[model samples]
Target: MARGAASERDGSLSDGVRPGEEPADAAPPALAIEGLSKRFGDGAASVLAVDDVGLTVERGSIVGLLGPNGAGKTTLIKCTLGIVLPDSGSVRVFGADVTDGRRAAYANVDAMLEGARNDYWRLTVRENLRYFATIAGVDPDSVRGRHDRLLDRLELTAKADTPVRELSRGMKQKVSLASVLAGGAELVFLDEPTLGLDVESSRTLRRELRRLAREEGLTIVLSSHDMDVVEDVCDRVVMMANGRIVADDTVAALRSGAGDVVRVVSADVDDAVVATLRERFDVRGVETDLGAVERDGDRRDGGDRRGPTAVEVAAGGDALYDLMDALRAAGVTVEGIETVRPELEDVFVDLTGVEPGEGGSDEGGSGEGDLSDAAADSRGRSP
Candidate 1:
């Protein structure tokens, strides 16, 4: 939410308004949540899906919502969208509280959950856009220009007249996204937006999302298991675990906080050598390239099949020196050594104690069936 001094001069703020002063017509943050809590059941069977969470997403920013399965991400989003009412706390969209009037608060909000929306299969891609726009209380004809642009940007213009049911899954996904934006929603929630996209299509979508946020001042809350997309497109990341926010910061800050590890590749490293190194250092993992020694002409005589082994040790600061000294004592000649910075996935694992794709099935107490039902209900109604 911090704005630079240059923002004032660059017309980022209302004219003549000083820094931190809100103009009468100034828009509030795209979304706001305070002390939000949701529980599925009572007594011993109860599960806290969202645990007194508070978050604010600035206009024109992309915030990545990340967590492993059953992390309450889905439940939290459902609560925010009024698909699942919270036990306590409040959700406000565009300065209107949902409790006051969901229709007014979410008038300009739209979401694509689980990688796709429920687009009309019988309608053409263009018709689907117009239909969604109409249901959202916008005149389809009035936003034809925007619809055209969305189709062009998503590379669906050629198939705009094609029936959505006849399109490939990837194309249908694109149409779903197009439908979400056809109404010119100011705030959009996209879950796994790039799920069915190819590499090129995914890149296109990423570029379009950045452009929309930068040029049109669109705000987005993106949830995806694809760390690269989140890191590439999001301004900030909010990570959840056990129905609570564990880390909320920029991707760079998270990675930097996780520190760095040392990768040591040596031709002399065998199981015994790795075991010795493990005793002295934090060995994250080891990969043995069976053909590396033959390829690099480091193969030994006497029918030794051992090849170059690369071991990643979580050795930061002075620990790195100890790792090197131990390797030398083991009579290991280092072939390659470099410090490897932790990625978002690495930091996620460090904080959550599990890989992004592995976790329990429940989001708080609600199962996948509950989430799907909520999503389906949301899609059936116009925000």
Candidate 2:
């Protein structure tokens, strides 16, 4: 996880959970930031991206801004939505001060960040959610039943009169998430909302972004390379790399410190059973090819290399039960053992040694033009 090994630890933001609701221990911070930083092209091609980061984000939580590929998570989500501009920080939204002159702290704050080009390609998913809910000034007769409940909770109310370039790219990412929740936004900011979608439209836009944070309390801030959609729709995962924030908690406390895994599978997993399972546990990645034991048991080079091989390690649950009695006392015939459980893509490839959309190519360059210049800096400001 090079890129300056995440400047040795500095992540903090905790009071998270709010899925089926229950979070009100002094509720405040629906996005506070602090000491944030950014840099980009100057001397020796500048490039610091974002560092000294801090975060808060409570109020109906969903937060998961993981990293990799210039780990600044789109420049800390374009510096917490003021659309990049943080040489030092203190953003604050629910406590106001969005760099003062604050349009009412972003008037509820909405964002879609260009996936499916944040719609309007010849409008009509109910006219691009009533013209971005009138450029997010809202009051479309007071959200018109919250814009038909955000197009029937992103099922897109039968494609709401279709045409944002004839839908599909997961129906223009649910009409760019119903044009950012048709301005009923209580903090949204969803950059790669299920990137290219399809796995039942990325599980129906992550179950309508967990029903917009469990029964409409809102506040979601998800960036994604889809670590299974940030381990099934994030309940707190922060991560980042190089430009700081090395790991914020909960995704079951970073998959409980990523310790237990132990898959096996063997047409006699060789190399002396991987040097006796790396002299007893903590190995990590290996795969061999009895034609990938049904396509994902691993192994890749020209497959069908006569039968089995796959060994993953990392133990510690009584050293994985004494590494299954030391791989059956070193005889190794186990054609498959289990107990893996530790994902968020193995804690984002062990805290960002590059793997989610790995250093580039999950669409086009400059991370989709830096999320279309932060969704054109929230067009005319504040949404």
Candidate 3:
């Protein structure tokens, strides 16, 4: 079994249910949102940020929330956190309803939204954790052991005393993650946690989050534009587009649904061979290497450089064999050839009609919309 395979027993404490009142074997889902819809503004200017969204997250599982910009990803998160009151919907954390602004259910929940925006810039790394811990009603002394372990796992122990203002962006991000975990929250929501992080820092954080979910039985909901993070860490992916969920499935299942992509590269390819190749397969694009460009001397004066060193095409399984035969018959220098299996990005593009980060304008951008107005919303509320 995987390290973080979800346990059948629920790990959260539901305030609405008393001990022995409910069935001992049945555990409520970590999160349940039904008929959730939210719109920004009104009249003709109104933008439907979320449209009748329904989702359920199992206990002790890692779920990825993915979407292109202005796809209501942020709005959905706000609605789930009680930051933005939904026009119509029901939100239940564990078993306690939070649909109406009752945030007491959030006692077992914590969020790391807007990257390190929640961290106090002037406070030391340790101080930031302590502050949030206290505010979350966690006893610092009781959690001291768990807190130290979190620091070591996240590699923030060395800079425990360093002021947040002086740390690198990656380090500050880790501090923010530690703060969320320090409170011993059963469920954590992370929005773009790896947005600005370097490769190494991002890798470390993913590992830590997975460990928390596996060993500590923590339920995590992670939202990010970084496909690699979602593919590597999440057990299931819920993809949103045009303010609605278009697909919900595991990463492998989604990838399996895309067409097989084949990449062919050759230095000896010429215009006739290229044309023949395109005719044989559903050509996506051809990329010219410097050598290929040099071969086409007529293109030296910035004319049409038709021949290329590499070509990517989509082909059926049997057609793929014919493509190979056609290339060899044309005496093309087949330097490299392989089937490029679909990745999470391919699935995302196929479902959303646009690539991640390429957003459709309804509402929300870098500096506009409710997401940009972080000040208007508190930890769980977005104005």
Off by over 4 Å in 3: 1-24, 265-281, 289-308, 321-336, 360-369, 372-377, 380-383
Could you tell me every candidate's TM-score relative to the true structure? 0.87, 0.33, 0.80
Model 2, 1-383: lDDT tens per residue? Answer: 00110111111122344345455666577888888887776787577877788889887679888777777777777667766677887888777778884566776677776442666677678877676667665545556676787787667788788687876676787777777777566777887787767788788789878866776568798887767787788788888887788889889878878777878777767888788778756788787664545335654443435667778888766887788788778777676677787777877788778777767422223565755655554553222
Cα distance off (Å), candidate 1, residue 256: 2.0
Order candidates by TM-score, high to low.
1, 3, 2
User: On lDDT, who's better, 2 or 3?
Assistant: 3
List the candidate 1 regions with Cα displacement exceeding 4 Å.
1-27, 115-117, 293-304, 363-366, 379-383
Instruction: Give the winner by TM-score: 1 or 2.
Output: 1
- Per-residue lDDT over 278-366 for candidate 3, one digit per residue giving the tens place of the 0 to 100 score: 77677876777534433333433323544446788787689788888888899976766778888899889888989888776545333
Q: Give the Cα error of residue 46 in candidate 2, in Å.
A: 60
lDDT of 1 by residue, 9-67 (tens): 12132234444456677767888999999888779977777899999998888999999
CA lDDT of each candidate?
Answer: 0.80, 0.70, 0.76
RMSD of 1: 5.8
Give the number of the best model, judged by lDDT: 1
- Position 90, candidate 2: lDDT: 80
